[model samples]
Target: MDAIREWLAGHKREVIRFAVLFMFLAVCLFGLGRLISGNTAETDTESLQLDETYLAASSVESDQTPVQPQESGPAQEIIIVDIKGAVKNPGVYQAEADMRVIDIIDLAGGLSETADADTVNLSQRVTDQMVIYIPAVGEAAERPIAVPENNLTEQEIGNEEAGTEKVDINTADAVLLQTLNGIGGKKAALIIAYREENGSFQTIEEIMEVSGIGEKTFEGFKNLITVGAK
Candidate 1:
């Protein structure tokens, strides 16, 4: 024991130096762990986040609109006609198959102020080359048909129904028309036979072309008659 005490006393400086070196090593290792701690963990977390972001972007692209697939099929052609009077944007436009006049009006920007949509036959089917006439109100009012002095007697007809004649260009025969003061029996028959063989007349002036109608009689009946329209 005396000899061991002697040796420890002599080596006390060396022991103190060894202890100080060991403490310095421990401090360095702790500092190194603290400095590198945040960077490595952050790198691993960022890598994971980048992988998740890529996955999310991939999913988004699949759901969005893309070029549609083409189909092998026959295409169809469509014809459209325009309506101008009393309509908005009165111009040409594309039309769908099995379309109606009302739908075409909607595409032309809708009706204008003068458009009496009630008078228009919206239910009529649209035709490839049909023309629609939109007549103004009162434009089609019945005109006063002047009765010839001896033509139709007032005694036979009532006052309420007097002076109005709606001439049927298609069916008026010579005998019936001879009832008119200016048209003779022969002329009346000519009118009927001509109207019977042919289809309905397009214009009122066409009646003047019948064999016996002179310029004077045609002038007298000019405003009184209409063809194909009320």
Candidate 2:
């Protein structure tokens, strides 16, 4: 018993030293675990912040983008006209409403040097599908003198009552001639060409001399037309 007591007293200091070493190792392991947990929490917070920043940037881009506007439809209405004869260019042309004969003549490249401007009413308002004819110089003199609107003699009024108001073939413009039955732009042009080439018609039947007009066609409008004072 006395020997056992002496050995225990000598080893007590070594046991105490071993116990202190074990406690130090436990403290180090606990500190490392706490550090790992803190780092994981920080990493998650940084990832969430990055996601929020990306979302905010995307929202800003969406807001800053521009929207496009829509286009309108075509024009409402259009006026179409045919300009022929002594203009620089002769063909169909598009014109606006309220446009005058002079405006359209200009659009057709204006009158040629041979054009008899006085033969046409330049200030007349244009209409859709209207035909404008410009005569060459000296041609107007062959046309019957257009009776003044205000001073009509009794014979002239009697002439209007005698039949369908007879168109003076010698004086009629292409448009005025077209009012006759079966007369169109082509036939009207031929009539003017004949007049310009052959001088004024000596009789209404002379219209058949123009190409495309035959005896049958002339007979149809014969009573409705006159050659005026030959």
Candidate 3:
């Protein structure tokens, strides 16, 4: 019994030191495990928050997109018409495709006090480059004019009526030019050739500049012809 007590007394310090070292290692391992778990949880929370924020931004952007408008119809057609003679306002005017002669006359501030309204077909549709002529009250009519005691012959009245039909040199063909006082087929051809070579004639006087035509020839048909609209 005295030998056993002496052995236990000698090993007591070494056993106490070993136990303290084991306790320190266990505490350090537990603290390391807890730190790693906390970091992982924080990372997962941040990832979830970022994913939610991105989804919300996408939804908002989609809601703010603009819608496009639809087209209605084709554009309207524009046309030019020349209003002349006894209209209150005599000039060229722009008109829509659907416009009639009366519509154009209205655009020209309606017919004049002396306008022969019955001589014009107001219901007729207006066309591009069309010329609308409104004659005066005493001018040519579908109804015959009373031959006064002044003794004007029927043939003379007929000649006067024929004079009112002025030929447009700018648009006249060979046949139409022949209707003029001194214009023959050859002269008509030369006129057309000159026109083609140097664009359209700017004025009725410009026809005198054509080859073989002079002031005398122009004076013969000057009152019977027009240059029309340029």
Cα RMSDs, all models = 15.1, 12.2, 13.2
lDDT of each candidate versus the true structure: 0.60, 0.72, 0.72
lDDT leaderboard ranking: 2, 3, 1
Q: Write the per-residue lDDT of candidate 1 for residues 1-230, one digit (tens) a residue.
A: 99988987999998899989999999999999988998899999999999999999999999899989999766545644535456767544556556777877788777777766777777665543333334345444122122222233333232122354555666565433443435654666777777777766778888877887766666655554557532
lDDT pick, better of 1 and 3? 3
Candidate 1 regions off by >4 Å? 1-18, 24-117, 139-230
Worst 10 residues of 3 by lDDT: 143-152
Q: Give all TM-scores, in the order shown.
A: 0.31, 0.35, 0.37
Prediction 3 TM-score vs. true = 0.37
lDDT of 2: 0.72
Q: Can you give the lDDT of residue 51 in candidate 2?
A: 100
